[model samples]
Target: MDHKKVMIFLLSSMLFISSSGSITAGESSEKIKAKLENIDYGDITLKDSAKVKPSFNLQEVSSNETKQNFYDERIPKVNLESGAVISQKNKQIEIPFTQPLDSTDEALYSHDLVIKQLGLANTPTLIPVMEYTTRVEGNQIIITFLVDYTDEYSVQVKDPYFIRSNGNLATPSDVYITTKNAPVNVDSPKVSLESGTVIPQINKEIEIPFTQPLDSTNEALYAHDLVIKQLGLTNTPTLIPMMDYTTRVEGNKIIVTFLVNYTDVFSVQVKDPHFIRSNGNLASPSEVYITTSNTPVTIESPKVSLESGTRITQSNKEIEIPFKQPLDSTDEALYAHDLVIKQLGLINTPTLIPMVEYTTRVEGNKIIVTFLVDYTDEYAVQVRDALFIRSNGIPAIQSEFYTTTKNDQLIVD
Candidate 1:
């Protein structure tokens, strides 16, 4: 603390005491009245008032506590009307206040207002109002805005102290409201079929997506007014008389299923309009055409002919006759009559060789015939369709034993 000499005309003349023209935080002038109380008038030197005329003046002052109490009473407490439904097709809402507000546009903005859009089961979404405006009249505040989407709304006011017409501050407020539906719903339902859509197999599903919730369930839509062109034969699609296909509703989509055929194609549309939105709006009509995949071809039995990288060599003692499929049995008795070993006869005709030393066994798809013959001997082997049956019971195509085989130049490749 800096100590200095204070010249007072009298000991009781505290009103004339010199101040530094300021007070510290949380300080009051009344607290300093006792600082001069202990001093006696006899010890202080008196100055001649006539000779020392004061060259300065003091400003009027009052206690801070008294001023604070008076100011608090003048601050107007504000109240806003609740449950006010928004009016007018135009995008604007009127807020009714309890007292008249300041005429300036800045006073309206002093209360930081926030608008939020509410939905049935969705979280609150903020509506940014950078271009919003407000006009005050009488005791009501008309808040004009461009926010136009949302089934309901939540209006909020922050601690932005607004000033009243009498220079008193208006307290902050909060409000909740439900507004009329938007003039036009941009989220109108839309639906379409996937292009080039086809059911690849039976018991498969084709999902059709919708932009918004459907008005009714799948059963109601199908039974009331729904046109579905069921798949028919190739180039002869027949729209079934009855609704044999199954359908279910999942979220914002419809799942459809049927006894799928390879030639099934679908043409679905809504004519009487049963697929409607929640807001009573008709779902936009879309021509959906779906085609099925081509019918798969049936395969015949594999030929028992020479394949690439494989050829009949007369030198090996065991002649491997492949059936191009797994053989059902490996017992030599099963193929005894069906197998015929032949060689070139005298007139170049096929002559059957004796089967005394020949042994036959099944190895995978090939029939291994073991014999005690020289490599130079041209032996022919035949697998008939009679006993040489496939594992699936399909008989092998008939194979002729001409030379040592059907033909010397037989190559499946």
Candidate 2:
């Protein structure tokens, strides 16, 4: 029988045996039931009575679900004893402790550990940690680096701040790292040019973005050492003098600005750039070849070759032209054949002059146009091609300045 039923039967038997009445068993049974119902079982204390406790198999049943959970699985309920233990600096370093963790896969990459920095670069320098790592054998953290900046680094743990052990962070100051001299790898210092390095125009600044700073203090020295060559097919190598350029290092880029104006293919490179890292490491001399875009030449307007350069009091059949830059004297002949002198008729229709004779000459920055015949009525002139070449060998943009003028009246149309 069950415990409850057995107890009730034994109690009833004792009651029947103790009865001093000359009564039947069936009558005694009914009286026992009524007496048992009247008994106050709620007043009993089972824990207090040793005798009752041994007789019944009484145990408490509960449904108090799960006890506790972790906020971050990587952070275990570590024992607070001492700080961490870092070993050495190499491609990898291990921070170990004493205890079993609930997981072997550490959820560490998320923190950087606040690990004081991040991300990789191809040396020229600051050797950053590998972008992410997740290897941790219970109680020990293994960090793999992108670059072994130092051969031997003493590992340790103290703290004002970071490194995730004790379920807290140990900052760079927390973990003592002694870095030694980096091995001299010829390919150690690396760099790349930002896109669109080719300059489209002249007399503007071009920035050379570098991985590390160049010797910032030597502006004049860099300008002297660096060379800029204006490249062309047929002429000897024309060098843009250092006096016509300016160099400076601003925001990790060497900004070489042009002071003089010209348009052609040009190359810039450092002779001995003296690229220096913040830690005082020097990068070897290297060649950086970049080309500036070669664009067409250009000019200012043209007017009558008079004292006023106007046709107010018609004097001679000549035109004076001003150009953007000095003309290459050799290409002066190239400009002559391309000139189209015409007459704007009374109806504003242009009539081309079939036999026009003119001689072109470069007078300083001006081109004086002396027409051989005096055929002035309402003359207009226009270029037919990019013929006027600059001293730097770049031609002027085509068919510019369609100038018009008339005889006698105040006209330089």
Candidate 3:
């Protein structure tokens, strides 16, 4: 063999030994020899021998992950004081723990811890808590959000799997906080009646406006006090009573319809704080007095006669007269005195009819008349000359009325 060949073989052997030695040294550097305690919310202090690695990256970790999935597993859960958490944009939040967190390894727990403000019913608010850095500081972890705080808050940890240096995983849990400093009347509900609406008309509507939108599903409208009374009458204070009136909400206004019996000078009283707003707030109480006159509504009185194109015949003893409009049947007194038979045509000589028994009724838009009289020839009947009032209290003009006659056999021989 040649000297050059021997030298080349020696160089190759040395290179192999150096490469193998370096590979063995790399393994020792990567091996961990440090110990760690439980991971908690706090600052971290790294030691030369720290070995526990976090499951996620701290820089890219978000505090929002713990909002919905946080669970506490302790036998007796720990919580912050009631209403102790105040919302602040740049303020530091100090969360104290029962025990100290392991700072020997910063990577044992995730940095995705977050603080959130709890709303009504312990639900989270919509405002986002800005990203924050975590460190094991004594027995507490300090947090800071990017936005100002408007409510109480709680703490949550994402990737709560707390791994210790001994390869043991800690139970996952969350911390809740409350605040005592809050606005006294941040969400109070308010309402007011429409202006220039002190007097509501009979069967007319009035509206009440609210400062905020009301709860559409709330049944507060059903709980109301409706009373009506004449200003100077000696009658008892009457409750308009349920079912007499109606109330409903349209948008932010409450519509109230009055169902009154009379137009006498009366006062309508409604109790205040009668409803609840959508924000779980109560509606303030209010009273409104409605003043109206004793004026009665009037309608036209109908003329009495046979139906149009109808004629009185021997077999047609019934007289049906239609009115110009639909009559208000609610007025019983008007129907009783509005009609009277004055004259009866007997033997074709129109003679005064006295002491005649008759029956009067209403059907649809017409008043029906019937009488017991003997007819021996073509005849006619006349209504009395008087002003008859309609069912709605409107008086009909004084006019003479005559029934139509058709030459035929007598209605009753």
lDDT of all predictions: 0.50, 0.46, 0.43
C-alpha TM-score for every candidate: 0.27, 0.28, 0.25
The runs of at least 3 residues in candidate 2 whose Cα sits more than 4 Å from the true structure, single-residue gaps closed, are: 1-143, 146-318, 323-361, 368-402, 406-413
Query: Which one wins by TM-score: 2 or 3?
Result: 2
Candidate 1 lDDT score at position 148? 52
* Residues 31-122 of candidate 3: C-alpha lDDT, one tens digit per residue: 31111111131333334113423233233324555532332221111234432333333555655554455555433333435455443334
Best to worst by lDDT, what's the order?
A: 1, 2, 3
TM-score of 1: 0.27
Candidate closest to the true structure, highest lDDT: 1
Report the lDDT tens digits of candidate 2 across residue range 1-413: 24444555766674432243222233476677665555445544444334442122112222223112232333433232232223434556555544443232265332434332211122132222344353667665666655544322323333323235554443332433222343322222323454324434444666665665544544444455456765433342545546677777675666778776645455566554342322223333446444544444222323223332333232476666665566656546545655676665657655454334677777765566776776556565655544343434444444443544534455454
Question: Among all windows of ten consecutive residues in candidate 3, which has the lowest summed lDDT?
Answer: 29-38
Write one digit per residue (lDDT tens) for candidate 1, span 1-413: 11123443232243333354232223333444444343343433344324434333323226677778867766654454443344433666666555566776544552456655543323354544454566677766666665555344556665655546467656666555534553424344677545423323334555566777554422334322346664222233444422455556666665666544433335555445433443334456666444333333113444576643354654356667776667656333345456667655345645444356566677787777766554344655666644333333333566665344323565535
* Best candidate (score: TM-score): 2
Stretches > 4 Å off in candidate 3: 1-186, 194-197, 223-232, 265-274, 291-413
- Poorest stretch of ten by lDDT in candidate 1: 1-10
